[model samples]
Target: MTYSKLNISTPSLIINKNNLLSNINKMNNFSKKNKINIRPHSKSHKMIKIAKTQLKYGACGICVATLYEAEKMVENKIKGVLLTTPITNIKDKVRLKNLFKLSDSFMIVIDNIYSINFLSNIVKPLRKKINVLVDCDIMYIGKNKISRTGARSIKEIISLAKIINQNKYMNFRGITAYAGDIQHINNYNKRSNEAKVRYNYLKNIIISLKNNNLDPEIISGGGTGSHELDAKSKLFTELQPGSYIFNDVEYNNVSIYKSNNKHFSPALIIGTSVISRINKKQYVVDAGLKAISADSNLMPLPIEPTPIGTKYSFLGDEHGKITLPKSSKIELSLGDKVYIQPAHCDPTINLYDKCLILDENKSIKTWNIDARGYG
Candidate 1:
């Protein structure tokens, strides 16, 4: 089960199962204690094993960002799926209908009359009713007014809901408002306050719906960065927080989660080998931009922190330069393995064929990044 026995070379992403399970249990318990449903987003891990673990840990369902993602989850026997994004095309409609036939419960987001009509038409002939959630735009508008985040306007949401209320082929579920922009505000208080504003806006909308005789069964929203805030907000009944299971550097830097000194253990890393050393103070690893993602605005953290005077930089397509101080005692030799914590796990994982699930001692257990390249 160890890495050496697996017969794989370096430059592979390794996942720590122990750390992953710890995060999953923490989020699951948090949701349960607060009386909220945990629906961790599957777009982060994209591994069936991880999805199964979340369900076992008490997740009511799993959330996906795309139809392709949902298709992969269905293959893994994931029953309840909430597609956070809108689906409009005819091919997607047909595919969704087929998925509905296989899945126990599936819901999609719709913003306008066109998408609502399209979904209704597709589901009508099959004698099936597709569950729909109104995607509320929760963007901050600077005057304490929250605007539509991505989907249609409030008017559009009500209009679509009215259409679904009358349609036999569609079931109006609830509302999905994700304020992703406020997740990493750097200040916990500021972020929480801003999230509250967004939450209140959605709550007001739900109240309005109730006054009109519409009962929202699902008020779903939240991301990894705002899970704590959203859970206590009393506005969200179901939380869709991804990235909590395997957090990246960007999420780790947030202020709320960062305590006096402790932090969430990063569950993913890219194992690379030193391919060349230009000088006593400088070296290069086999991993480059293609191997690791840098969208989080930081280079991967070395498993063992680089020496006091060392730094890493992307050299080109397939190489990374590590600069070291001349007086540093540590010297990296050719073929020596160094683990790198990627800045962003999602895109970096897509670049890999599979993930090497490792235990405390770095033993490898094959876990396919099965949903990779779904886009």
Candidate 2:
């Protein structure tokens, strides 16, 4: 049905369907052209259909941050589910092994020998190996890998790979280095240079693995922040970009390209209704701190119920205020439908169970954020 017919409540998540598809295709096309495998992270949209759409657009697989997400993907028969985090506890270890039986393409990453041994023993009953990747610490900070994040040093990472290769229950796929700390670097030249160094460091590590006759078949870990560089770099065989599918205020503000990026448009927004007419320039909306994410330093950008350039600000947990241009002729009334693009898409999405998607015909569709709160 058309968006106008539905009684959508204030502070609801909305997705522009055409923009979503276009963003997906744009990233996919970029990956194909650069000879990099696209494994879009499910942590962004977290919807089963969105993940499926990604696969349909040539994503080699789906990367999930939690075992629960992997289970959901496997349960839905979504192939190539890669759990980016390491499985530590017995409960999750068992869950990981069970996932192996369900999906042949299911994969996990390891950062230590104990986890390797833990996973190997549990999955042995299945008499099959689970695809394993070594999580290399590439924070590129401190004196060495130990001082940084991830799986310590090059020696430590290689040792994990060696153990994986020795075990019949583990398939040593490759190493993964996700620079979460570096993805949001504001300066384009700085981000690019930093990524190049990290990729080179991983390259050396890859060479070391090759010298030991354990050349990796899959080197994963490129994020939305570094996808362009990641795609061009010969280091990562596959990239797990998350945010590009749904651009947020932070990602769109000259962060990746060092200039204003017109590549990806915001597909997600919070649909709110005007509740109070405070003044001509200032009015309160129903969306506030709880409705949108505050993790991002910047506030959500107003996109609807406006004359262009309307500004938004937080008023309370359940309220926000917007300001129109001083000289504007337009006037806003109570009960006006308002939409604003979030500053951070991932965590903001986790706050909701479903999103209103606007199709090409301007009709509204609802897709559940299935992986919400799946720890």
Candidate 3:
């Protein structure tokens, strides 16, 4: 388990186990304080170990982005999977039925009457009731047009719920309005207010539904960027915060869950090495576009502080150029280990076969990214 004994040739991802467990506990405590259930999104880690940890910390269930993900999670015996995406295809419907045989509770989101009708027909034959959530998009489609939240509009959502209510094969769970676009709103007040607007919109819909004698048991939404805001708003009865377990560079920039005691540390890292040193002001790592994901605005930086004027730039397919300083104290020789904080943890982890679970001392234990290749 020591660093020297560990294999370092292949591109590997490391997860700080302690930091991960701590984040889970913190989120669980937050949910408890606010009287809400924690149904963390599984898309962030997509690993059985991490999903189990979330459940250990009092998660009511795990949320996934697709049926493929739910199938994999059920294979690992992770119960209570809530599929955040709509189930459309017939093949996927078969897979969902298989999952239902294994899991105690399952949920999926639908945005249209077609999906509802399709699910109803599929589930009716099996004589089973499938839980359904209405997906609402809060972002404008383009140029100030308020885009339809998955169910298209409030009226459509109510209609869909009524259809579900009428169908004995389908169960109307609640609405799932995700304001995903506002997760990284840099301005604190602006992000909070914007999220509030979306929350109020859904809340009003819920009120209208109740007025029509339909009560929703769950009002789920919010991501890592706005978990606290969603929790405090008293809008959602349960929160599905995913990235909070492994705060990445994108989330760290605008996170409101700060701690004076101990913050949620970045549990994931890409361990690369100095494969080639080009010059005094530039070097190259073994990782590049193929090794890590750089969709979060920038490339990875060295874990420790680099010298002044140092910069790391993506170079082609398999190289990363590091601009060194003139008076740099860093002696990054050939074969020196470089820990890279990934720009996006989810996709970055997906590229690897497994993740190295490390303790505080950097000792490693391997955990298979069991759901990595599910898609």
Q: Pick the candidate with the highest lDDT.
A: 2
Which 10 consecutive residues of model 2 have the lowest summed lDDT?
140-149
Off by over 4 Å in 2: 1-7, 140-149, 255-261
Model 2 agreement with the true structure over 140-167: per-residue lDDT tens digits = 5422333333686778877888889999
Tens digit per residue, CA lDDT, model 3, 107-126: 88888888987777667767
Please count the clashing residue pairs in each candidate, in the order shown: 3, 0, 3
Q: lDDT per prediction?
A: 0.78, 0.84, 0.77
Instruction: Evaluate candidate 2 by giving its C-alpha RMSD to the native, one decimal.
Output: 2.5
Winning candidate number (TM-score): 2
Which of 1 and 3 is the better model by lDDT?
A: 1
- lDDT measured at residue 214 in model 2 versus the true structure, 0 to 100: 90
Question: By the TM-score metric, which is better: model 2 or model 3?
Answer: 2
